[model samples]
Target: MWYLNDDLVDSSYHAENENQVINHISVPNIQRSQHRANLECRARNTVLISPVSKTVSIELNLRPLSVSILQRHSQLSTHTQYEITCESWGSHPPPTLLWFLEGQELKGVTTEESRSSNTSVSRLLFTPTPEFDGKRLICRASNPLLPGTAIEDFWQLRVVYSPILSLRLGSSINPNAIKFQDDVYYECVIRANPPAVKLTWYHNGENLKHTPTSGIIMSNQSLALQKVTRASAGIYVCSATNNEGEGRSNPVELKVMYAPTCRNDLSSAEGTPVIIAASRSEDVNITCEMDALPESLRFHWAHTNTVGEAVDLEPEIYTSQGSKSFLFYNLRSEEDFGTLLCWAQNSIGTAERPCIYQIVPAVDISNYKQYPNYGIKHSFSSSPQFPRHG
Candidate 1:
């Protein structure tokens, strides 16, 4: 007797000898249950001779596991539904479909069987979020035909979102006050899943023109302000836009700090010289003062004598606090004795004041008569002070 998977196989049972009988059946399919049957023979004489059936198992180790992504979700935008489809190719017994997210199996995905072909497609639908950006999605194909293994393919998601703009002050100017001619920088940083498409700048609600650099039109990121002036102060805003939408930053105030313009309304603008007589051929100090805003004023002196040509005088090597007029220390009768000109300057502008300067002649030494005494004291002085009678 023979059996195939516990079923009787008596058609090929025949007598091979007087006491031995054999059965042969060609296995058309070598399946897993092929070797699980028993082949046994029994003879009936005076008594029955029977043998126990032997168990066998067939191992058909043919692995046909292959999967691929036929079509995937094209809409890679955040807050939108995304869909993906994958198929199992050249697999026997129709491989099962599975889904994985971050190495973990996901449930609720169903496999679709093809009515015309032996193919099976697995589809997964999900709504993407910000956390799902750049996440990997997997489609797995597994079957009992492969025994204990599965094949999988993966896709990385690209989520697109609008740009969120943030404005910052770069290391060029402060918000309080900016100096004239100083460089200023305004940065418009964009935060988004996908990079921004364009950026724009506005001043006082008017769109500013785009600046070009290296053949590329630059808009966002950073803006350079060169040679800033008083007019550069204004309300500035930045806008950034992406495929999803646009974003803008709050307005920032840009104020420019500069010296005030030199004016002619000074109480001391009347060109009058403050004269110090130079006796004994020494130096003399003169004055021409002006009142100006932005008190960090600069002073310049110029003089022309009777013989020497007009020349610029070097300023004294010291700072004059709360006073605008500086002096020319050394003066000679033949060199620096004529009209002197003074100019006051600030960052805004410069103003000149002309004044008449004269050198008072020194008295002859013969006028100083010495008294007849042991110490030889002078009888006359240049500035005489009489004894106080009161």
Candidate 2:
């Protein structure tokens, strides 16, 4: 008779022609609960004396029934420390536990096991960086006795971080070749864990607003400047904001090329003439100042009379320094009295309007009468005449 843990084996078979009758019994559906069970075989010739019995203890090797990771937050912040635990049950000698990241084994992990309960546990201390986001983190369990049997619990990592920003000129623009009245733009490149919600632009430390009508068109990631002028030349920066934090880019400088223009204080209204009174045979000095990017200005002086006759002034009569020019004229005769036009030119182009000056004869003070404690009033029979040249 064969018995496995007090259960009768009805299908016991006997081998023929053996010195001692050999009985074979099969234990079906072995499980972890059957480990250390007793198996017994007994032989009785006359059913009277105590049966000779042979007993053996069964030790079963089983794979883990379940392996899982404890519930925890899926989202993690960069540079923060966290603890993750994994558990396995129903292995005979307790399964070997380990941690893995992106298919590579992780060292320095802590593990605990209980032989009485057939359970194994592993704990991993983790710290994540921005580069670790979207990678797989795994907790694997396997038994050394059972080859090629491994179970794992894995999840993709989500790491939160602040925004990173970079500011650049448009792809089609050349930093060294920008010019006035040219169309240009800037681009803001960003990288962030969470998408950026707001983007801001700055010029020379002042915040810039979106005003399309003024040639400043702004979008989420770019700024377009139409017909750029000298005033548009300055330092520019871009910034991005998200839930994590804000990030700012390095400053980019813009240089614009432009022609010379009259200085604001020296400029005159259109068609308004500046009058100069001087006597004949006297030398008068006229100065013209201009504003330009390159500051290398070329000046041209011309005289146009009331009779429509025009003559270019000799270069020897004028001196130029930087963006300013001075002309000396001697009114030796009436022909020298006329309209003086000062024209300035630079690398870009010439000024749109020339500075105009009218040369007129000075008033005679001897003909006016002065009274005590009263202002003088002069009465002349003839009006002043404008000079004519042929």
Candidate 3:
């Protein structure tokens, strides 16, 4: 029998009658890392050989089994089910498994485990809640192979949550161009973390004034902009940062329209005889008074049948707002008596009106000779304009 380091570790071998009795044993290494406190090793003779029995113990500075944890929970919640796997392996026997929160042991929880002929493994489960925030959780694995001999290892665990972020727009603005004097607003919203999340708003790569409000509403993440201007027309970004890391929202491009208080210098009034010649087979000159911020405006015209669909004229005429003349060279009979529509769209809205035109076959000039007293040639060169229908 022998004792090492004031009984920190011990060993013993007893033989009777020198009959080659078996009696050899070894003490494994035990180490502690920021958790465990002590390690002990001991050996004793289990059998009394005819006359004598002996035992020994030793105090060895061996390293304990290393313990680690693998978490399978992606999102944490008060009622969210999750799994935790704890594993510890060392050259020790009959290890102990323990769970802790804030350095306090959890009680009365059933534990399942497997041993590597000398190691220990355990799995535990629990629902995460807000109360778990800022608290340290740990798992310990210990081995007690011999009487009064034990070793242990431990691991730390952490929990995290997911966040939500979104953008809000007041009105739709044209991406191509903006006029002036238009009001635009941008809003950002998000669901804050348990400990809370810091949110920031940026416009056109620059931070918004008075941004980073500590808390706006119950939601930890939300932002808004008012009366958008040309400066507001740019990529907007929202970022949420916390101890866990950072989450950013999808970039949103803002377009601010220009709506000047004054009107453009263009007009289409009654008694204005604008001649429209066919520029192409499907061309039409459109004339209208437009108060466009771009100063002057052009109009486009199109002919549509009774079906409210477009039809062909002798010359196709496509006119936009502010244009006074259009040409149509290809006139299809199927498009006769169809309506012509003129529309102008700007940052505000679309200005559109329709006019009807009828196509008729040529008639003899003698049909209008009822009131002619002086001698005149009967020809189709001159014809009276058709009267408007009520």
Candidate 4:
């Protein structure tokens, strides 16, 4: 008798036991099933009283397809980003997993080893365009146990971005009330997400369809408009949008200005009467009045017909805080007859006043001039010498 793996085989009555020899037992193509099947075999001599049985056990293997996205649905603006990942769960020589985008194999994928497991995962990160919206992406797991068989999952891609509507004119430039035909400039700005903002202009709260001097530009978080116009005035508003959301700017007002135009007339004063004898001293005075904001006054005098001689005056230059006058001492000749000119100038322009003077024959002489005429008094005790021309 002989035993193979705890099973017995016997040959007794029969001359040859080759016909009763047991060879092999097995469960081929094992797979997860509702019930398990046991494998057994027996070998015996032709006339042996009992036959012996040998047994073996087999277990089924299974794997499941996995689902994950490089990320959850995210916002993308023109030239913005989106990504996805495809991975699975399996054992005994990890199964092969494949990635697909919009039902097509992912063109670019980066792979890394699992840190805690014996599995490999792949990633496909990319920026999606407007053309990528409403597309389908699929992930699958492939294994040899089920040849040409695979588990699958899918996701839908979305594209979201904001669009620019209109621009708002700020109140900083135009305050109070704006006048018509006034040259003016204003600024308009708006803020939004998902970039690529476009700005438009308006007049009197109406959309501007004509030539516009300003343009809209996009910054990190805001939009700008420069050098706006009076026609660009009114309740201005700006709107910005993206796949995420939209925003608007508060209203603004504008005003303009022009040059001031005004006119005025000057009034004169009656002249005072005064006389001066030839070869004698005399004093003269003139007055002027002007009209201007933050008032001012000025005085001037000049001979009209004098021949290269200024009337001898004690104080040639006379000055007061708001007025001026002229004086002469010991006049010697009669060439001083012309006119004394007094001019007053202000912001508006210049005005003038004049005085006329005539020279009369000398009569009363000054003490200095009389001294030469008086005869020398006789000496106290001697005869006074007669005055001589020398």
RMSD of each: 15.1, 12.2, 16.4, 21.7
Off by over 4 Å in 1: 2-64, 73-80, 88-121, 128-136, 142-148, 156-166, 171-183, 189-197, 203-206, 209-220, 225-237, 241-390
lDDT of 2 by residue, 203-273 (tens): 99999999988899998799999899988999999988888888899899999978777773344445345
What lDDT tens digits, residue by residue, belong to model 3 across residues 1-390? 333433433344566665544445564553332122332334344555443445333333333357776663444654466666666665233357777876788654455445434345667677765556557667766544434433333443345654445766534644445434444444566554544357777766776556324221223344444444545567877776665456667788866554321111223332222222121123232334444444344344566654567743332344332423344324334443244544345555444332222222223223334423312221122334332221
Residue 153 lDDT, candidate 3, scale 0-100: 39
lDDT of each: 0.61, 0.79, 0.46, 0.44
Please report, as a residue range, the 10-residue window in candidate 4 with the lowest summed lDDT. 258-267
TM-score of 3: 0.30
lDDT-sorted candidate list, best first: 2, 1, 3, 4
> In model 4, how large is the Cα lDDT of residue 24?
39
lDDT leader: 2
TM-score: the better of candidates 3 and 4? 4
Off by over 4 Å in 4: 1-23, 28-63, 77-83, 91-93, 112-119, 162-390
Evaluate candidate 1 by giving its C-alpha RMSD to the native, one decimal: 15.1
- How far in Å is the alpha carbon of 257 misplaced in model 2? 2.3
Q: Which scores higher on lDDT, 2 or 3? A: 2
TM-score of structure candidate 1: 0.37
Q: Residue-wise lDDT of candidate 4 within 310-363, one digit each (tens)?
A: 443223554423323333322334554433334444443444333333233333
- Rank candidates, TM-score, best first: 2, 1, 4, 3
Per-candidate clashes come to: 1, 0, 60, 12
User: In model 4, what is the error at residue 72, expressed in angstroms?
Assistant: 1.7
